[model samples]
Target: MHPALVEEFKSVDAVIASDARTAGVDAFALSLLKVERQARRFVTYLVFQYPCFGRSDVPALRKTLSDSKKVYFEGILRGFDALYPQPLEALIGAEYAHLKARVDEAELHRNKLFHGQLTEESLSRAQLLEFVVDMRRWCELLCDAGQQELGYAGFGSSSFTKSPELTMSASFRIQMQGLADYDAFIKTVLRRPQGQQAQ
Candidate 1:
């Protein structure tokens, strides 16, 4: 792992794990806040990862749309979708096809978190734990996928494990393969209808 990626992993994972113990409303609220943060970084990472961004004439995309934009996160996500076209899971693997749908669901949650009030809602420790795990999993998966899809081969798999004080520890690992899947995977990420990026 490069020092910079290691640093980013610690910073993002900590926010996801920090409120895993509040056990109720606090956990739910904090998890929402932290996941929002993680998702923002995740979107930004993918945009910068785009092959076109490194071009000398092209400028990096802004993470935000505008100061008055009501839905900051979802708007940025939409912008990426317009540019990338294919599902991000295409970078990870076929088994993760549902990951795109999950991303959509999470987007809805993000909107609610920002616009709606959370008062008088029923939440449990189990639910809180689920949120914590989801946020961490999403971030970890993206980190691994980013490297495998855009980075040099042979760096090995990217993984991160988080263990709350006494609770069962959770971990995720993405081992990137080569050659056999390379052509197919790149086709998906580039949204190559005929072995070329959609124009």
Candidate 2:
């Protein structure tokens, strides 16, 4: 995994267990947003076939997904849906409805938190942390799906694993097949209609 993600994994561990409830709330909320952004970046990478090695600051990705206002999580979902319109089990041997559900659920809390309207009654620390953890799991599931269906040579999958230790033990490397052939394959996939790409 990248150094920044390694540090973020450690920070999340601390916030999840921290006794500083007030600060933990802010940290957890911010972490939730980070997870959402990471999900968007993954979708962007899959669309453009870019391997970013777990970083989210890619210029081309930002430019592609840029909007006058903030990009909506559902908007990213629409692009992903367009890319893979078939039932996931038909392609990746998995069901991803849960991933979409998790994203939708997180969006609700995300809006409330960002607007400073989320309260203890509406979303407790335990609930907030649950969303963060679940969203992280969502990212991991998507990564696994990408590798299974697209033959993507990704190594950062371990960075999303759950652990109790605050150490960055996950080692990751980004790999790709022949650059020319891969580029052609991505172009072919983009050209085909939804669910009609040759496997």
Candidate 3:
């Protein structure tokens, strides 16, 4: 819902679509969709639990999972390249580089938080809140990116739809309860005063 998040979603959508079109395959679009979905599931878990944990603590966990996902996706791309070596070769190279950079950034953040001895006081609550918002926005952007890529892959306007099947996955549904728990925790935290003494 944040303006910055909205802008980021738009940017990711553009990138995904552009990348897919460049690769010229439905498989790439599908794989990106799966990656986006998984990322969303992880982020939603983090955001929902933001209140109970410190910012420094969450980044390490997130970074670890993100790094794993990046590796999985890269391998998937390589497999796709092996199957369709010509049209997708060049596109895979560029996309792999971009994805690797993102994974590296995530690792850097994780290291800063877990290994570099950062403290929660180093970042204000508002800043941390913004980070949560950004993470959610990134998930949305990744989804949009998949859609855009599908379009570029020549899926046609008819492929675009708002069906439950398109918008929701079983994995997403299974994680919804966990996300709800996280949201409840955040609400409880927000209701309390920042410096009020605990009973």
Instruction: Name the best candidate (by TM-score).
Output: 2
Count clashes in each candidate, considering only residues at least 3 apart in sequence or on different chains: 0, 1, 3
**Segments in model 3 whose C-alpha atoms lie over 4 Å from true places:** 1-107, 119-121, 151-199
* Per-prediction TM-score to the true structure, in the order listed: 0.46, 0.55, 0.26
Pairs of residues at least 3 apart in sequence or in different chains that clash in candidate 1: none
Q: Which ten residues in a row have the lowest lDDT in candidate 3?
A: 151-160
Residue pairs with clashing backbones, model 2? 1-172
Candidate 2's displacement at residue 162, Å, is: 28
Which runs of model 1 end up more than 4 angstroms from their true locations? 1-68, 92-121, 152-199
Show model 2 residue runs off by greater than 4 Å. 1-8, 50-61, 67-70, 85-95, 151-199
Instruction: Name the TM-score of candidate 2.
Output: 0.55
lDDT scores in order: 0.41, 0.48, 0.36
> With candidate 2 superimposed using the best TM-score fit, by how many Å does residue 21's alpha carbon deviate from the native?
1.7
Q: What is the lDDT of residue 155 in candidate 1?
A: 20
**Per-residue alpha-carbon lDDT of candidate 3 for residues 22-92, written as tens digits (9 for 90 to 100):** 32223223333434344344333323232333444455444443444223333333322322223232433
